[model samples]
Target: MDIALINPFLAAAKHVLKTMAGVDVRPGKPFLKKDDLAKGDVSAIIGITGVASGSMALVFTEKCILGIVSSLLGESYPKINDDVRDAVGELTNMICGDGRRRLAADGFSLQAGVPTIVSGKDHSIRHFADGPRLAVPFETDHGAFMVEVAFGKPH
Candidate 1:
């Protein structure tokens, strides 16, 4: 996979959390995801289509979700609920939007689909595409999570 294609998602995620949640996130060196289970309690997956086709997932631990939602809503959500899920979806949307705008400058005009959310212990989400995924793991004061991106050339 191209780091050129993957960097926007990483940048957007870090920028979003820092600007919106007031949280400074440190991203670990990216690695390829090879059928490994996701290390998250909740994940929001968004499809990218148009110039490029594939998906991106924002996976988060329960504590990470709670911390971000608390900053966004000004109230701590003691647990995961429907509201928490919705917040995750919206956060993913924001990151996708930022990434899309950035990718357009790199010649890929991407469109993001409605986010699909899943929550469970070790819910493994396989990429719908046959390409390798570039997984960027992040560490914040709240917890750790990952941003996984797997995309293809423009159609």
Candidate 2:
């Protein structure tokens, strides 16, 4: 695994939530994900290509996302509506962009595709890479979420 590509995302997730939504995030220990099942009620997935190719997913429980969007937009979200889904996509894009920027400083060249949203119970996140994904779970006052990254070979 190219762990060098993972740290930046962890940092980016924490930074994005705190800076944009004012939500302080606590990241849990990262572990290898052996299944495709998403950890939350909603997920934003983006494909990455360049020095390495793979996919990144930001998964959020309904309550966690509700709290985040509420804080981010200064409006209450009673449910996971279109607005909430849009927020998930935007957040995924920003987090990946920030992570790519950081990696660039270390000589990595990466580009991200548009994010796609998936929501429901027991939905699977089929990553671009066919292997165990690095899953990093996060917690906030409202609820918990997770970030998963699967890396492929360097191009």
Candidate 3:
């Protein structure tokens, strides 16, 4: 896997958590995983394509998601609802967008892909065997979350 492709995601995650969620996030070691899936309460994923092809997923527990969403929205959400889902989706999208721009500047052109939100316990996301997958774990003030990246052929 290309380390160049993973830097943007790390930068974007730090930026998004600090700017939007009002929380400082510290990234941990990056690891390569064959399957990156979690049995968690809340998981949001954003896929990007164009010059580059891949998907990025953010997964965390429901409590952690709610806390982050509440901080970003400046209100307390008692439970997970449509608003929470939308906020999470948008956050994931922003990270992807920022990552795309950074990667583009580095000579990799990427197009925006649709963002998807998934919630519940014990759910899993699997990627195709077309390319390498990287899993980056992060710790935020609210809780722990993970970012999963899958890269395909460059576009």
Candidate 4:
């Protein structure tokens, strides 16, 4: 995977988390994933088309999301509920849209589908592209989450 492709997402994730949720995020090293098992308890995924045909997913641990949503909406969520799921979906969409906007400035036209949220332990995330899955781990004061990207031809 090209580092260029991943850079936009890294920046966008940082921007979105900070501006929207009032959370500070630190990105860890990027790596190739070897399995479909989700790294966290919940995830939001969105498909991309146009210049890049692939998918992006944001996986969040329970603690991570709770902290984010609580800061974002100024409300405490004891656990993942319908409202939490909606927030995850919106967060995923915003990240994808912001990243796509950056990519567009680089002359890569892209479009994203509506985000899909999934929850549960040991859930799997299947990307639509046929290529190596690049995952970047992020740390926050509340907890940790991951950003997974797969950009290439559709499978």
For each candidate, what is the lDDT?
0.87, 0.94, 0.79, 0.93
**lDDT string, candidate 3, 91-128, tens digits:** 88899888888898999987766777887767777653
Top candidate (TM-score):
4
Higher lDDT: candidate 2 or 4?
2
Clashes of each: 0, 0, 1, 0
Per-residue lDDT of 28-129 in model 2, one digit per residue for the tens?
Answer: 999999988998999999999998899999999999999999999999999999999999999999999999999999999999999999999998898888
**TM value for model 3:** 0.90
Tell me the tens digit of each residue's lDDT in model 4 across 37-118: 9999899999999966899999999999999999999999999999999999999999999999999999888889999899
TM-scores across all candidates?
0.94, 0.97, 0.90, 0.98
Clash count, predicted structure 2: 0
TM-score of 4: 0.98
Candidate 1 Cα lDDT to native? 0.87
What would the per-residue lDDT of candidate 1 be over residues 116-144, giving only the tens digit for each residue? 98998978886656678888899999999
> Worst ten-residue run, lDDT, model 4?
1-10
**Can you tell me which runs of candidate 3 are displaced by over 4 Å?**
153-155
Quote the lDDT for 113 in model 1.
86
Give me the runs in candidate 1 sitting further than 4 Å from their true place. Answer: 153-155
